[model samples]
Target: MHTLPGARDTRRAARRVQVRIGGVVQGVGFRPFIYGLARQHGLSGYVLNDGDGVLAEIEGASLDGFLAALRAAPPPLARIERVDVRDIPPDGGKGFEIRETIHRPGHTRMATDAPPCPSCLQELFDPAGRFYLYPFISCTQCGPRLTITRALPFDRANTTMSAFSLCPDCRRDYQAPGNRRFHAETIACASCGPRLSASTDQIASALCDGAIVALKGVGGFHLYCDAGNEAAVRRLRVRKNRPAKPFATLVADLAAAGLVAIVDPLSRRMLERPERPIVLLARRTIVAPSVAPGLRQIGVMLPSAPIHHLLFHALAQEARRRGTSAPACLVATSANRAGMPLITDNGAAHAQLAGLADLIVTHDRDIENGLDDSVMTVIDRAPACLRRARGIVPAPIDLAEDGPPVLAVGAYLKATICIIRGREAFLSQHIGDLDSPQAIRRHADAIRRMTAFLGVVPLVVACDLHPDYPSSRYAQESGMPVLPVQHHLAHLAAVAAERIVRGPYLGLALDGHGHGHDGGNWGGELLHVDGSTWHRLGHLAPVPLPGGDRAAREPWRMGVAVLATLGRGDEAGRRFHTVPQAARLAGLVAGGAFPGTSSMGRLFDAAAALLGICVRQSHEAEAAMALEALATAPRGLVNGYRLNGGTLDFLPLLAALSQPGMDARTGADLFHGTVIAGLSALTASHAARLGVRTVLLAGGCLANRLLADGLAGALRNAGLNPIMPRSVPANDGGLSLGQAAWARLCLKDGTRAGIPGYERT
Candidate 1:
């Protein structure tokens, strides 16, 4: 090794060293930042991008200071997961330079897509700028990342941008060290990059004329129509095979969004954030009723791309000429058939959306991966991510400790996968329900893609305990160490993973369905968890599920089951006389040929049916949502309930619902009030016995705003801390996170520790 001349004898000799940094360092201007930092310190070295991460060799008097600064302040978009430093011999290099990218077999972190920066937005509107009115304008701080990247090292050649060469001015900016566009892989100008075509103008005009337009976006294709045009919105909904589900709307800005929805401080901030997720907010009367039928809250979002900005600008100009306000809002729903993967390729979109859309507006840039826009809402005055995708995905979550790599296959609905390497857990984007062949194939593809990108070979495979789940079957078929985790326990663990809560706390797992430890269908469970161990403290009274899965789709059947459970079987047929299966379901309930469940979702279904709100559901959680919407006033005259040894029975509430002359709205309010009062009392009793003060609310049923808000308020008023998920989802979407967390704990505690469901393959 060559040291500084005459400095070898000094206590601190100037020697050369190599450093490798990993985690989310590519496509985020890391090399340019390194160049500026090196020059600032007067170092002689070179930095290059590689499959693993950024590698640099530096020879300087202040090498230690340089390393400290690199860690202390990184780029705004860069996330440093790990740094490895080693000594190296000096090569007597004179100046610092950025070297060519090196491709290898190792793994590296990928950055999520970013929104357009302020500088790019300003330049887009400048008439003299070269990129004025360009839809593909972007810089290092903004534009597509995961959607365009095809391989590691994150260079232009490895991305879809290879088709568009930079113009002379753009090339100069890219090569200049002082410019922000320096080393920006996606940088392009209209002269040499992808150009806007006349078809886009036609599509924009059609949108203004109240016609549905399908436009290709960063992640996938989106169906767009004027939000104020009820006819257009309804037509699009009918064509897409969606009737009651609310469609998310995209507006030009915060002011435009406020005209249709009640935007508070939190909602406005979430809407304006770079991620640009759909934020659920209270709706105003100005919006078309067809946008969100029978719902009080509407999903709202702001434009995140330059193309969206151009469309809004064109609409504004046309509206000004017509002497009216601009068409500031558009229904931006994903362009896909019912229960299928999102359309990514231009040809596929044209083939699938030809009949549904009046015009198609698309581009030539390829989308390497397709993702949906994320969904967010405020729970307990904090932002809760309901669907994690697009601008927020491919980002790793930190764990408490490092362990062996594990792959967790999540639940059947809201499917996702989790890959744990070292102390970072990488989660896949939302994969739809695994009921159809297409959805199942997409789920498998997601696993393969995520594992390949992260370069992880899991030492253990984890999944839910339910044997019928496709995820469980997939894990069983794999020739690896398998671990099955209980469903409710996993839900509690997901919340604990996000909150970093050390257990011994009460957890309420309320959802649609999950296999129970007792071989029964379980939900609405009260559990106490600590580390890898959990104990069921109590649960709601079990009721027969007549006709099995059919009872879940028909709320009237559940109402009849409730009547039978209350020892009023003779009235079941008479109570639901309108339902065709009412008499048969009563006979089935009497014959005892079906399994019983303790599901909170079934309770909501019964209430909705008894009040004549929703007797049959065309989608998941339809009855529950309808019941929540019917509760328009404060809780009125809560009915009585029975708290037995460990089971909370609602027979009294059911009997009250069977009585005549009760208004449907008032009955809905009463049902919600009874549940809140009963559950709160049950929790207070158990918490006092266990001497615990923290309570976690989890599971899919918690998605209802009325229940979550009411339960949180009651828990706080009782002088206890109520914890809800903030980073991960509260639904089955977060199952894999919990499964991975529990698997790590089980591995740490040893295989024969006597945990209930810990079995190694």
Candidate 2:
């Protein structure tokens, strides 16, 4: 033992302490790391894994050094959320060691799947190494965790890895404390682990010949094709029934990604996240035109699995062998039909993707949870999440305060669930819309899996106000007490929860659609929220929506409705003669038989239709996205809006776009600028009236970076604090988070039945 400076005997200075660490410390080599750390500090103790997290004891004269090292350095993949130390008498043990995992009743966080670490990549390329060119190379540092996990106490017995018995070489590596794979649940080699059904060379050859391949990944199957081949991309689009929706491109590395998209510092940071989310960046000229049609930005990502590197390596070798250039990137997209959940089953992939994929490249490993790739963008110079899945899900978001467990089932579109336990909220991966039966089943399965893994039995269940939504119905059927929250209020609460706002704050919700508390249709709204109570302050002026929901899909319906509302009913038939329903829609609008919506999304659609930008949409937000991309020079018409007590009207702006010979680019620019100007002024006025200084901006329409950034800047200029959603999405993907926040407050206030003004089904 090392001698202390003041004591001649080392025994006098020796102190033993037990440390309890929580959060993301299981199945990540935490115990092995602690053992190594203790030995380095001349401490004699043992580290063990429990249901709660990692527990360790150290006895040494250099106790301070040992504790400092624990706080300063931990395993790269481990996330130490909290540490609790208790002093104990010296054990006088001889050597440090790792103990067996023990079961306990407590909470533990799940780490999302990560890409291969640098060290693994090095061994993958070295010819002399045993794992050279191995497609399933993994270690404690990086690999599948949440995807392969079945239940908590994340042991090999509870994971998909239990199927493969360790061979001699792998057993040695797993037992050796010095090896990187020591105590790794996913320890394996090519000899005994999962094997690919097809060779890398064959996959590369098929891609080179313009064939779309359905390749299995850690989360789900991905249908990938060569991005440089127009015929291939177009065929994939046609076969997949995705005509104009952009497909994300998977590049070999940062250098190849740079060739296709401009990677700013903000974009690079998100791109480099361990989970490797698909980041939208400025597009260059390296991909096929059809890959991202009519869009100025493109979604780009690096390889997330080992097979991708092996495939790209083969492609590079082929370029040298054939004296030809390889494709810049691969068009990697989720392997699912339109409006369906991602396919994870091998048999299901083979059955469903038969027509879409020319070949299927699969492995034997089972995917316990099917997670789609997460998508991210930059808003206000910060990471704005579009979809939370794969590398982003199953990870807990730290809440501002501790509360009883609550399960929040999200709204209809972009469904997700949140399970709150103590000061942490575990938001599920992006589960597509709850429109289809299969999607609802997926959502239910996700909730079951997440709650089961986290061991959370909620005291109350929360859902959207709309009674008919599948999620709302599910909450009603859940047996637990139901707490219904208003749509827009939940949106505001979500932003506030993320920002941890302390008091009453105003919120601006620029959304596409949400069921209002008054049974009216609302989208563009301003709300004031405080704890368990909230009030609707103001909103955008209402406009007639012909055909109700159908008007969103067919912008021409909105266009004709606007024309009829403007007292030019006869012009609709003449202007949109090509659209068969235009005349009938105009008739309906004239008769005032249609309902009205204060949706900024409908306004965007109306502007697009008037400018002749897009008559019909191929996907959600297609028209709005196209319109935003076309705008170049923005010159908003002066005094083009009207502000009544609480309503901001844009009829004059729509009337301007409805004029004949209005250029699409000029019309788009004017519409965006005017909306920003009008919203800023209205929000500022409300803030002054309410004496509130903080403003929370949320809802789907805020997905528009131009509008989000513009409104944020304007709000700041008005001497107000604007809080935007950072950890969660601004769309319905984040609705459950807000619902969770509000539900927590409602539970605290003894409003378990439901919040005031929100009707319970």
Candidate 3:
């Protein structure tokens, strides 16, 4: 190997370099790792964290070698995005040391909370260990981060644990350079940490007695009950105002989880991973029916906090005393009213969950940011995040190009905010639907906190085209230049952003509803997206949405409208005889009193209703999911669609569904197959016409495994490459990223072009 003159000079001279390391370097023991690395290389300097990132000044003979090693290997949980090194005059420093964190507002990236590592778990169970029976046991590698952090420069004083000072023994561990707990800000023994009182014991007893217990965890309080207790689960459902939405289960271990749900290798890994998110898996027969209600899949997760483990430990001991297996599972659902923010404070938990929980178990440690457990599921053997929060949030997404500061306020449902600083887009944790006052407040708070922490004032604000959306309203009131992005266009832009494919690509967006540029409701759409501009090439035929939004909640109403659209309005009365409003809805559709929608989601609802799979929806996407579940096998039938000039009609499919002797499952399978065939043909024709090979699939409807997997396979078989979101969600939760990407592209192009509200911005 030949070395350049500059490289040779760098290797030979003793010099000092200022290194700034960015990306997830604040909370995961990065300082300790840096300290160890510097000492190992015989370098003398100090490492400190600031709002921007980790900054270090090292003076050593082998500066180049040190920099190489630092970039190659970091701490187990550290994510190094960029490392900037600059040469400077050598400072006469003797020993490597960890210095106090520098407080710089708006430049630091917050770290996500992590599950307890194996070492910490073992120590938690060891009777002789100093942290035995401690509910808040954590080390440098694990524990709460974003949920407990109030500000940047993540030190103890800036965390919720500041009030609980370290004891003498813990102080020794913190000061010891060689100890793993050295400089671990959250480190504390049972003697000095947040104390666990008799309330936990009472909560455990309540669980054993089939009573709901609201117990505080790392993020927020969770209402828990025995999963096997049907009455208890039902009582909780009635009390919490949740009738049918499935509750997530917290299992003691992998074995316990397997007993309730089918754990494939991939799902098992996700369940045991450090993030410890709730993984939706196929249900077995062990769990009570009421736990998940009408769903065949159950959401299961292992304990993410030491307090949860301690509660399970108490239950296991009691089970051992009785000579039986441990109580392996608990129905752990967020302790909040329907459509409200998660309960974070003890007083709020008690007040809000009064009738729902039989006992309340809490600690003194404050929850700075109330976060719910993240939910994920495997779709086509790939992990898809349903809700991003807790263990999976505050981690920035890297964009292909850096742009000016911008804020993207997400959709009305699954609301989240994205703050773009340079090339990094930091998405806030899930803020949920912006319908309620509390949810809207949470949306505002998240924006304020994220902007204040990141130190970026957005030059441009992006939001949905729907003027009624709370997120859009927030942006309009933000006083910044506002850009209203079409909902489906934003979905396409999000996929492009994640894949870094800036292009004129074919996009298929399928969802329930989005405001179309033509003032119509759009869902199933095909478009040509280039940068910030998109042209609608084709779409599903519009059908009346009987009673408007009411049809979304009642699939039977949509089915009647489908019948009316097919000129078989007489069949609606007999086919939907059980639903009293069927005749009225049919009449309304005939009278043209309802708005028309081209939403693939309403199409799914109609199919489910016509097949009697789901007549009404209790939660979002319930009918669509039930319809997908009924599709047990591929029917290989694809003759039920008509593709005309830029219009794909499914009236033929509705006719087939209304056949007298059609099997419900076969109809569902055929519906899915026909949709796949229709969409693939549509995308292929358009892609060929436009000379594009890549097809992007997005929208909430893509969350359906059958549709996502089937369409991708079909598109590929048709000689077109298909792209979908992997890192971000495909639903409204991911709309913020797309909005931001589109805004950035528009600003880069220097033309208002196709973006809405561009002049206002």
Each model's number of backbone clashes?
0, 0, 5
Q: Give all TM-scores, in the order shown.
A: 0.93, 0.97, 0.95
Backbone clashes in model 3, listed as residue pairs: 51-107, 51-108, 106-453, 106-454, 106-455
Give the per-residue lDDT of model 3 (tens digit) for 617-735.
Answer: 87888888877777876554556888997899988998889778888889889998888898888888888878999888899998788888999889989999998887778999999
Return the number of clashes found in candidate 1.
Answer: 0
The sequence of per-residue lDDT tens digits that candidate 2 reaches over residues 1-761 is: 44234322444477889999998888788888888877776789898888898888888877776677777788887889899999998868899888887877668777779899999999999999989888889999889998899887878888898899999999999999899998988988889999889988888888888899999989999998999999999999999999999999999999898999998777888888987899999899879999999999999998888888998999887777778888779999999999889888899988899988999988998999888899999998889888888888777778768988889999999999998889888888999988789999999998888788888888778899999999999988887778888888888888887778878999998888889988988999998877677888899999998877888899988899889999998898888888877887788888989889999889999999889898898898999999989976555689878989799999999999999988888888899888988998899998999899999999998878888888898899999999999879899999999999889887777654443334332
User: What lDDT does each candidate get?
Assistant: 0.84, 0.87, 0.85
Error of 2 at 602 (Å): 1.1
For residue 112, give model 2's deviation from the true position in Å: 1.6
Candidate 2: count the clashes. 0
Q: Considering lDDT, where higher is better, how would the candidates rank from best to worst?
A: 2, 3, 1
Best by lDDT: 2
Could you tell which candidate, 1 or 3, scores higher by TM-score? Answer: 3
Best by TM-score: 2
Clashing pairs in 1: none
Q: List the residue pairs that clash in candidate 2.
A: none
The candidate 1 region of ten consecutive residues with least summed lDDT is 1-10
Q: Name the regions of candidate 2 deviating beyond 4 angstroms.
A: 1-14, 89-92, 752-761
Off by over 4 Å in 3: 1-14, 62-65, 197-199, 636-638, 753-761
